[model samples]
Target: MPTHTPPHTPTHTRPRTPPDAPPDAPPSAPTQAPWQAHAQPDHREFDATLDVPYRASPGARRTISIYLSYPDQGRRHRASWQLELRTRKGAVLRRWHGAVTLGARPFTLQRDWDGRAAGAAPLTASGTYRLRLQARTGNTVITQEWPIALGIPPRLAMPAFRPLATGATHHVATMTPIPTGTILPSYTVYYGNLHSQTNHSDGGGDLAHCTGAQDPQSAALGPPDAYAYAQAHGLDFLMTSEHNHMYDGSDGTNPNADPRQATALYRQGLQDAIDYNAAHAGFLAIYGQEWGVIANGGHLNVFNSPELLGWERNASGQLLADTETPRSDYASLYSLMRARGWLGQFNHPAPDQFKVGATPLAYTADGDEVMVLCEVMNSSAFSHSADESESHRSNYEAVCDQLLEAGYHLAFSSDQDNHCANWGASYSNRSAVLVPGDAPLDNTSLLAALRARRVFATMDKQAQILLTANGHLMGERFANCGPLALSVRYAGAPGRTAADLTIIEGVPGRNGAVSELAHTADITFTPAPGEHFYYARLTQDDGKLLWTAPVWISQQSPSLLCAATN
Candidate 1:
């Protein structure tokens, strides 16, 4: 069947947020306040859980444990704790208020119930529930909450598709199997702000929030259709970074003035994703929001814990976990997310999208951070020329290059930023994560790999861009550079049955400047000393060319003499 690209920008407009709902919601649990006193910097821990096989016949006690971790010290914080359980439909299921020992500082906290609700009331039907934790020390709240999932029975519920949080990263797809005894690597992509018909400034989608909730057309193409499309097109995962009307006030900076309808729609979209995931297993969707900051270039996406960040905004109209600080910008958010062990990345920063500057990498202080990634491909900018698209891709590549040059760690990815399915026709099956086709496509495993700096990107076609150093498949690097030995492959039936490979290189540091390196049937690029970076493009005999992100190179030579001179 012939496919058409979804519209790059939605035509229908949505209404601005109403004057009621609180603009800034509280920051979710996992995204804790940066100032929560890490007195024992080693005492901090991140906990998560999963209960996928929740249905176990009748009278069976289904249970899952809260996975714990202390990235610092190897101490266990196992002690008495309290548990909170909520239903999939957003209702309090039961609150187990008691002292339960955790035993291990970084261990799973498991709880089993006899399929009962409150007061020993039997849970009439089998389903799913959300579990959260409150760790305390001498009546003091040590941790706000540790979110986890529960498996009740009959598999009636599934988790929601969350959007990437501020400075977060993401991905989707399958890959070839690696030889035995050798470990294969995976990649992640992150994106958001897919407004189908909602008010460009406010209005959250009305129906599942996949599109504009206010627009009937968008409402019709809700979560189910998105899920079906992903599964049919071989996509591994999809995420929605819907704008929070509550966070973006009517005036653009009022956190306490979001309309009720927008808030309701955001709430509904998250629920829809959770409900859809329950039925479709491998094809996953995540729930997240654009935290809708009103600043010139301040738009941060938040995911995972929705309830905690309910109405957490400040006078300046920016998201305030507790109080505002110097690092309130994108880089600061990245730093905070990395410190807390969450994946974050900088979105597009061009004049049309973010209007911040030519590049957003300068915002990151010290230029040295851990577990961070950047957006190389944004869905909104796909239709632009190859040179235009490469600018953003180069921005991310430059960051990756700086990190590699300085010995710090960073990664790369691409995102649809699909507000609706408007751009799907051309970009159909375009965005994806390169994970081992055999690995469990579950949230825990995929998310862990994503945070570990493993990912790649395809701008608008299936162009193969491989990053290897010294013949070793280590983690990815940002920009295309010399001695990097980058290989790009493109294979698609654009118009003709056969395809041709071409190398596209940008003008050194100027992303917009471009030149053709070579046009050949050969698929590999052996970089020369002056070649900064190179990407492969495939064209059909009919003349349709597909572009891929560049494999960055270093200007310095390998020998000590050349390296010392530069």
Candidate 2:
């Protein structure tokens, strides 16, 4: 047997061949293939293959080799190529947008991805994703995509930064309610809806789109139903943010179709929600709208506001609706929102729903009108994690982690975006804000807390955690030093002890890298250093915790560096 042992083929490496790929003509493909549409040519059939490395280590860098070969006049043209790597979530994890001149043959275009958002700052969590590619030569488009796994483990070594104080303040954080009211920042469930739907004259279908149809999740919860649901849930207040789309020219039967109709409906819906809240003693409805320029595929939101602004779209053809294509770009919409004197936030976004081409493009520019708070977690969207049902909830946390890593004013929310009216049966109202229900409810009290950005989103309604820092308290404060000073006190659902918490701080970068200041076991740092930001990662006696909004030296500082800025 030993003498007869023949040379065996090495099994470790094999010739990798790509599977069959659909043509670029599929309507749902990533994009227009970077080429203008053209009638099919009789002799032109397009096919391509790319060997992409898989199972990359977390925060690691790798390259892919794409073989481009096509039959032309019985001759084979070949070239090697590469493309950029982004977060499966479609964030520009790396911005190595590489392209090649198709006229050159057998030449490759290389893309180097550093696995960082905005092309810097190494990522923290690791996950799997797909690499989508599209190539075009005039009318000929080639599309290729492949699966990839990213596994970035936690780095044992922490970064260097000045530590901030981490402890609870004796006093509770309070906001002056509008129109003279007060609400405690303690309670279980808070409710709200995306108001653009019923408020408009045309009765827009869902918050996901402006089309008129029964909304999928929230439409079922009409006025009466919502009131009953709030009572059952022990909810003290409900918030509705409708689009200001009405122009005030038509009645309900023959609602106006003009853009003004949307604004008008928004105002009317606000009134209706307020009236209903007033009628119901325990329930209150706060007024606001998800206002944005519906141009250029961008979405921005103004949470608490009455009067809405509609901008005239210039020659560029932009609309600020939260649709796949806003008639206006980020700049126009941001400017309009800022000019109108409003506060806003970027909405829920995840990996599967929008891989860049499927929804309104994420804002990449800088501007003042960008909302100070980013909704890191929202029930409106699904997470890309293995758990599809709780993806909305899980993705919310994941988003918070990412934003914290990138140093953004990330806040958690559980909005219904309630277009259909059924209480987000599939998606959970997981992220929620706690408020005082002791006194008579008013929009001013609830909204004041929300606008101050002191809130947390949770998976379970029975769970609650409160945080504060150095006598100047906020929602949930993070204790990162000496005795890890901060409060992890909770209410409801007894039989729990020892609040499990993880605190993170955002640190600026030197070489364009985004990262957080390392967490410490004790809370001994001085509170006077007004540079770092802190937020709590609180869990119950049992391992259930919600990520609260960042409490920092200046809440508005991070907005300056936010990607949402136009």
Q: Whole-model Cα lDDT per candidate?
A: 0.38, 0.39
Superposed Cα deviation of residue 459, candidate 2 (Å): 1.6
Question: What's the residue-level lDDT of 455 in candidate 1?
Answer: 46
Candidate 2 accuracy as TM-score: 0.51
Q: Candidate 1: lDDT of 415?
A: 54
Candidate 1 residues lying further than 4 Å off, grouped into runs, are 1-235, 244-275, 291-295, 298-328, 351-416, 420-429, 448-470, 473-484, 493-534, 537-566
Which tens-of-lDDT digit does each residue in 148-253 have in candidate 2? 5556322222212111211111123343221112223333335333222332322223324321223222233344454454445455454444432222322111
Model 1 weakest 10-residue run by lDDT: 1-10
CA shift of 472, model 1, Å: 4.0
lDDT of 1 by residue, 495-514 (tens): 22223345555434443444
Q: Model 1: how large is the Cα RMSD against the reference?
A: 25.4
- Give the Å error, residue 72, model 1: 49
